[model samples]
Target: MVDQASRMQPTKSTSPTPLKVVAATDLLARVQRLRDSVARRAYEIFESQGRTFGRDLENWLQAESEFLHPVHVDVAESDDGLTVRAEVPGFRGENLMVGVEARRLTIAGKREAEEERRNEKTIYREPCSDQILRVIELPAEVVAGKAAATLRDGVLELKMPKAAPAKKIIPIGPNMA
Candidate 1:
């Protein structure tokens, strides 16, 4: 309880401090390990979900895989441009309308069948040209302004030019003197 600092003579204080150095390679390896762990965990989740939804996935794949009837449509792309061809079968002029929104293309049209006597002996009946209203969104942006559609030989063909790549800036000299 005595006032030691006020009464006693001052002396120099000395102590040895601890220091440590860490290698950059060790830190990088630790970060890499952490990243790998997270990736592995993500894959594990995907695997579980894939297993659980296997049936639904299979059903969807199968349904989307084939063309069941004449109403089916096909889409193909080449270096020249994009081509959308649909099997309209018997659709007539001015009845089918093609629309383009942003990058999506839609075809909506009605197919009419002339009315027949219901009481008469029914030989047979088919689609009689069913209505076609198909809309597909493009994977990338398209030049919708220059888009064109034509129906020929019962196949609706849509020719679209893919969006041009952005141009680089051309630096100009500063106007200031």
Candidate 2:
């Protein structure tokens, strides 16, 4: 018979895989596509509303909601490092990922829904998912390895130390005509 301790021993993986890095150009293209989709949806909404004057902001907000679930974020700079705060309710620390690569900061989160009775009749349902993704180019370089992130009270905060800015010396040219 196998001993209890031996049977309860935990197993470890033999190998680990590295993470993939997304190109900046690809990120930019995805953002552009989202923007275009929002614009088109907003225009359609305006037309559906009988082309009423004013309410541009409302239309845009509606369009954005349709295009993507919004994740409010605030970025601040300090002497120590840059801090990013994001409001992501319905998500726990395990559901979020914050990383910096190629001078770009990426924030991704997802909240999975529990299984429910599928055969039951449903009255009204609003599609919802606690997923959020945003990629932003940092104004200054950052130390990715030293970065830290914390999630509290449904808010996610990240602190990253900034790297020295690149310097360039240009020669003075003769006065232009």
Candidate 3:
């Protein structure tokens, strides 16, 4: 039997961070992009496999791994800005490239290939390289120049301040009667 004081309790933080939210439209677009890329790659894989049947799932999984596997991100919106967190394991902060243009955010990275040599003799060659390039269309307009990003523990977090909505003024027609 465990007493109340003996039971471990979860630590509470003072700061309140809102839950991440991805817009439906953005999610749909991302899915569509993934589907298109995956389809194309899968078709290529199928052709490479001599147009074999009963391997639809295998082809799709391979295509997904090749084309749509990296830079998975979760986007959240707040009154002040948009927050984007991306999972980028096995990558260093210096290897990542984050950019914003118009209403789009792009995340890209590459892993260098490795080669093994024995006594200056080429024995084995392995290409375990990977590249990730993902462009996300923001739900709301943001000031690209003011964006900030940080990479820690294989995760990238970005904050982009929302752009002020455009304003227009109409001339009064002398108080139309």
Best by TM-score: 3
- How do the candidates rank by TM-score, highest first? 3, 2, 1
What digit string (tens of lDDT, one per residue) describes model 3 on residues 126-164?
668666667799999999999999889988999999999
Query: For model 2, what is the error of residue 86's alpha carbon versus the real structure, in angstroms, after optimal superposition?
Result: 0.5
C-alpha lDDT (0 to 100) for residue 6 of candidate 1 = 66
Error of 2 at 101 (Å): 2.1
lDDT value, residue 36 of candidate 2: 95
Alpha-carbon lDDT, every model: 0.68, 0.81, 0.84
Question: Deviation in angstroms for 143 in model 1?
Answer: 1.4
TM-score to true structure, per model: 0.45, 0.51, 0.57
Clashes of each: 0, 0, 0
- Alpha-carbon RMSD to native, per candidate: 26.8, 20.4, 11.7
Ranking by lDDT: 3, 2, 1
Identify the candidate with maximal lDDT.
3
Model 1 lDDT tens row, 62-111: 22322123256777877756888887777876888888765798776776
